[model samples]
Target: MRQIDPAFTGQPTNSKAHKAVDPAPTRWQYRMERLWLTPMFRAMIRTGIPSFGFVFLFTWYINDPVRIAAMIDWYEGAVSAVQDRPEFMVSLLRIEGASEDLQDDIQEALPIDLPLSQFRLDMGELRSLLVDLDPVLDAEVRVKSGGVLLLRVTERTPAVAWSYDDGIEILDATGQRVATLSDIESAGGLPLIAGEGAEKNVPEALTLIAAASPINDRLIGLARIGNRRWDVVLTGDQRIALPEDAPAAALDRALAMNAAKDVLARDVRVVDLRLPGRPILRLSQPARAELKRLQDLERLSLVNTEGTQ
Candidate 1:
């Protein structure tokens, strides 16, 4: 038996009939197929989508204020737990090279409480605070291994006592102000300097004081004159005014004169050493009047002798 042609039915067959076309995909389907073939789209599917989903869920979890507060509290609690460990605690403070009075000042100045965490201490700031004190020349601060806060301080040594119009202040060798004293005698045998700008010329004053050692028993102090020169004030109001340049040499010269002639013991008010070659002795009021009276008597005698001759 012959097979029947499905295209040609038992009815009329028209030669002019068009062939049936194969079905095409929809626009959305075609676009989806094209997108699937792209490498960027595949990468987005592999990584971007999962990352976005994770971030969205995370954001939702943390969006609540209560959850944020809980997270912050948990972080702070963890930090506090680490900081409060026994091994990291500073329970003792040891001060070295500081005097008893300085220790008291340091203790009063420190803004920390004992038995604190080492992590909470600011070493640099503490050292700066210690050095800021007038008596403290230098300082070191460190935390030892066995929970000790160690402080090493170097105190300024008082070299001279500066007495100005206001008050007296103790100065170190470098002329740094150390402390205030009630009086010049409280400086404890340190050389005394007086008047304005005396503190700045401490070295010069000390030199003069050294040079005047021979007459130290009669020396009172060195006074700064016009912030340029010094006047060595001795007992009985005798002043030896020294020049600005090589004042130590001029002081030495005056000291030599006093030693040789016993000039300072006389009725002298000032020994002017401003000129290196020439020394002027300014006598007291009584000595000046007496000298004037003797000069008048000598002149009267000379006049009377000339008239008689």
Candidate 2:
């Protein structure tokens, strides 16, 4: 046998004589320490865990279509509840610059019912409907404070009453139609115009009527002759032919002659002013005979005077 060392001998060793031995780390703990030192592992712990949790929640939420639809419905209902409050509701419609009839028509054309929320009303569509009326020139729609739907309109004004084969049409100053009437007599004091394209020449016709104001009350109507000239008709079915050019001047001249010579009051059927230089008069049968008789008497008086000399 080999010689036994004193440390291996089964004798009491001094407490401070042996060196202290350190405990070795286990395999799993050593591996965990190494992983914590890596940059990729540290980055995954910092960012990857939160990302995975968010993705899991998102997938769970999207998997149920009915729940998503119910959430949307709840959101819409909340919005609608806020919008349908009494403060935002339109209970009355206030119309300015419109007649009673036009107001009725506007009410008829409205797309929404009264006592409804203003949030549901489309102002552009409302304005378009109001503008479609013949008399409405322009329309403006707005919501005012105190829950009022304000509609301000500009209406066409009737300037003349036109009479054609169909009926009477009321026209504005711009020759635009305002309304239609069954007869010219029902159009109040507005001057009557007849024949095609007469409404377009209303300004000239009005000028002519103004020029002949002295006999205006006795005037019956004005006619557009072949769409070129005007014929001023009097109460007794007498017609004054007007020249296409300088008609207002010719009318003034004719009225001046009538004031001095009583030309119009005489038994004349037609006063022909188509010729600028010469004015011709067509007399009734009785007036023609009387004129012939007067001429014969003047000639007889001249012959008797010559014979006596």
Candidate 3:
């Protein structure tokens, strides 16, 4: 029952004499490997084609001239809607330069409540009016989303009050006319300046007066002379005639005399401290009488002492 190769048994047989069988072809199996990789490469192309197609379609739709025209129409409608609102009109009473109430006048003309975004700000009439009223308006107006106009303002500070060309006016410290005023009492601590160029020299007078205040509280007012000379006035209607050349020295001497001899408190009419070496004293009648009484007392004491000797 066992079949054995005759070559191994060393027996010659026809079946045992056949050639060796060949190995199966591996090339056919290699061709099947391409199927696995082909699908992945093809799927990449399919995904990119649809993505690109959607991008081109949407871009064309949005940027088309028709869409741009529609946007313009919408903007015009929005502007017309709010252009007639009441808030855009500015109001002024007795305010100068504007022919009409800024608020009321503008409203009457424009009659629009259009939001700022829809309107052109560079219109010639608007810009001219804004510049013309810049000094008074101080506030810039802007229309908002709810058809409400917003105003922001800043005003300048006036410095002084003055009387010029027979008309009284309030001026800033720099001498610019601010407003017309009634009288000097309401003008506050500004010096009563008169004569030529008083406004120009206010700063100098203010400086000197401020310096003298700490030393003398009786200094109530000042009078300037000939644009160069100055005179100081005190309480009780007493006037101190300062020197034309050295006013500061005159004031210093007067203050010194007041501290040493209570010159200001004396019943004197005026103390002419202009001459430092020899001051001219103008005495009231009562002050003269008091001086005589003091002299008599001194003489009587001397006479009594000599008698005792």
Candidate 4:
């Protein structure tokens, strides 16, 4: 500042008084300090730079067709190396609690080949497929050590032989069909039942057969009449017509009568138990003829004796 004596100048010089120096920081410096204080900005400055550089270099390197193909091949090769391990492969299927025939069926029905990766086998789908078989009640599938796939199952047992017109099918205790039979003798000792809807009412048929156990040797089979009633068929072409309700009781009554009066042993074609109290006996053709002849002979003897008197 150039100062002049007050005496030289009359009152004040034409010099602008210097404004009080401003104490605040410059605009650019303040903005830079504010940005540095922000946590996100600091983090971006520290980590984002290296991340962006590495990503850029990697993308540029893999942009070529050859390099891209090679990278994909390396990934696939690594995955194959892990998946092809012996522990991850299934070489043989071990079936437990299944018959030889059923095992054969499973082996033939499986959609996958052996030596496949265990990861490729859907356990839920495999179990469902096994349970869908007629004989399989339930099945459990699992992967075991030594590259084996184990299947445990429960098989249904044959309870009765259902004889339809076309063929016979063996059924379980719940009337579920198990398998078709080649012949009736193949049913072992299972009782045979046949009629319009006998297969549907197998439980009732079984009950009736059980009630007729006394005459099992003479029993041929049970015939479902009108899909509602049962007719106990026996040898000699005889039948016991049973009522719809209380059929077992009706059968018991017939058995009791036969035991006492030998009704079943006689030439009776049918014992009609449909009516509650009185049972009508329909005689065979030969028995009816002999009965009519005997009645005529008695009438003629009475007439001859009266004329002589």
The collision pairs in model 2 are none
The TM-scores, one per candidate, come to 0.80, 0.70, 0.41, 0.77
lDDT of each: 0.91, 0.89, 0.60, 0.90
Supply candidate 4's per-residue lDDT for 71: 89
Give per-residue CA lDDT, model 4, range 130-194, as digits (tens).
99899899899999888889999999988789888899999887889889988999988888888
3 or 4, which is superior by TM-score?
A: 4
lDDT of 1: 0.91
Poorest lDDT segment (10 consecutive residues) of candidate 1? 6-15
Candidates, ranked, TM-score:
1, 4, 2, 3
For candidate 1, give the lDDT of residue 240. Answer: 95
Tens-digit per-residue lDDT, 1-309, candidate 2: 888666789877677887657698889999999999999998889888888989999889968999899889999999999999989999988999999988888888787788889999999989899899888999999999999999999999888788998889988877788898987778998878888779899888888878878998888778999999999989876889999999999998889888999988889988989999799999988889999999999999999999999
Tens-digit lDDT track of model 1 for 220-261: 888998999999988998899999899998888888888899
Q: Which numbered prediction scores highest in TM-score against the true structure?
A: 1
Clashing pairs in 1: none
